[model samples]
Target: MDEKEVPSLAEIHIAASHLRSMSLPITPILTSSILNTLTGRNIYLKCENFQRTGSFKSRGALNAVLNAMKIDPNLKGFVTHSSGNHGQALSYAASIVKRPCVVVVPRGTPKNKTDAIEHYGAELVICEPTPASRTSTCLQISQERDFLIIPPFDHPDVIAGQGTIAVELLEQVPDLDAILVPVSGGGLISGIALYAKRINPNIRIFACTPEGKMLEECLNKQERLWPEPPQFLNTKCEACRLQQCGSLTFPIMCSLVEKQVFTVSDKTMIDATRFAFERLKLVVELAAGLSLGAIISQSDRLDSNIRNIALILCGGNIDLNEKLPWQQ
Candidate 1:
């Protein structure tokens, strides 16, 4: 499959079938009491944090890894670059199929995540914590070893795997006016908008980012990609903070996502993370907070008529023993 093109609906359905065979059933979408009260709109949380490997990333990793080995039995192991959650996910998935996996992560990744990757028995290579460095390291290793690369985002099978969330969301809720998804490389949102828009065009999809997304550049259809940040923001959203969005993700986002991509502050994200812990009794990761944070900070700008909203709590790979950011 061409890496640049957006995945078709049929491709997503095929990936869903592969996933179901592995016993990866649909995750639950629960109504959050505190969040609903806070937003004045019925807020449903798609709790992917409870998913296998503690993140939605498992869906894509398993799909891509399993499908590859299934096609070519003699294929070598997998390689990938991740900030945190995806590394753990790929490592866990590779362990399932008894394949050696190598993950290149940025330096200073949360110990909890790196520990999980090691626990899954993958070799971890820590590099300079930048998008370029991570990609370069991973690509170099993959090319040198002739191993299949399981991307965190920005691939056909991977995108389709993530799309399964939207398929389940519609089935669970039936009717949702708007959905706020945390966007890092745009994989999740692209996969989501692909299905949500296909099923019901009326459902609005918003990409929530912790950094200050330039509205003009983001909305420019010709650009079809996130502008490279001059300097990465110091945010606890470890899964995000990339220099720019993925090429495959950008095109889909440009076509399907709502024009106004919501940007929230790091403080708002931290507060949202704390809110989920204290109020909802859910241990959500910092990157997942972008969805909830956008709502809290931009409540006035949201559609007044929106009755039902969905938020994807994407991961919970936090170090339980580590002090919460608010405590410091």
Candidate 2:
């Protein structure tokens, strides 16, 4: 769906109001010295690490589920395949509404990811870490059990819900020049770009994917009659390394966004991770640190006059003990 066709400003205001009524915590933190020092720009870290279920996925999940609940009071079940955070978000949402959940997780997904889902009382189904298998497994289960598919980053409601982040950011930093967001399936970035651009067409929305991932190519392919699957490039940022971008997100990003796609080495993610722990005094996972890494990698590209910037800290659900490849 053309994000433009999805909702009007007046309609979006009502949607945003409905989301706010859920009482989910929205955090917009202004703390990032390294980013400031590197780019000579005032940076605000939208610290969504403190969000419910410890990630921004909660925003999209709740929006999808509650909206689904409104349509179908007896929502049969909930289902999704995620690397980590999104699964936990869906499971937590399911628990709140007392619905059964079946999560299809990649085989190598961290133990903590599975644990969180189970803790929320959702059944876990593990599959190979590939886009084909993830989709296939989720479809199979959804067919058998009649579960509502809550895609990680690929639905209109989910993207608009995630856009609420940009809504809060624009309110928090009215003069914000740029916003950096991590790109796994493009839900968060799509949402942010849609609303931010609708408000101020000049705001640049950067897509920060794992190093070497062909996100720029993926975004372009989104315009075709039969768009190809996202070309998966393997990297140590497992949480953010998707085989492809989401179908719904890809098209919206290609049409609406003007920002270029950039990448940071696993090393930058590691350093940024440590930086968040040491300097920001927060426990952020590799996915959360990608925004910092993107700013660091593209520090030279940004105009020095661009003083106000925003980075979306997406999640913090990694197993702290497991040595990420960058750490070693």
lDDT of 1: 0.82
Candidate 1 lDDT by residue in tens digits, 270-316: 99989889888888888778888888778667889888899999998
Per-residue error (Å), model 1, residue 244:
1.1
Off by over 4 Å in 2: 1-12, 128-130, 217-231, 324-326
Clashing pairs for predicted structure model 1, backbone only: none
Q: Which residue segments of model 1 deviate by more than 4 Å?
A: 1-4, 107-110, 128-133, 224-231
Pull out the clashing pairs in model 2.
none
172-267: candidate 2 lDDT, tens digit per residue:
887888888888878888888888888999888888878666677656665433235656556767668665666677777787765467677877
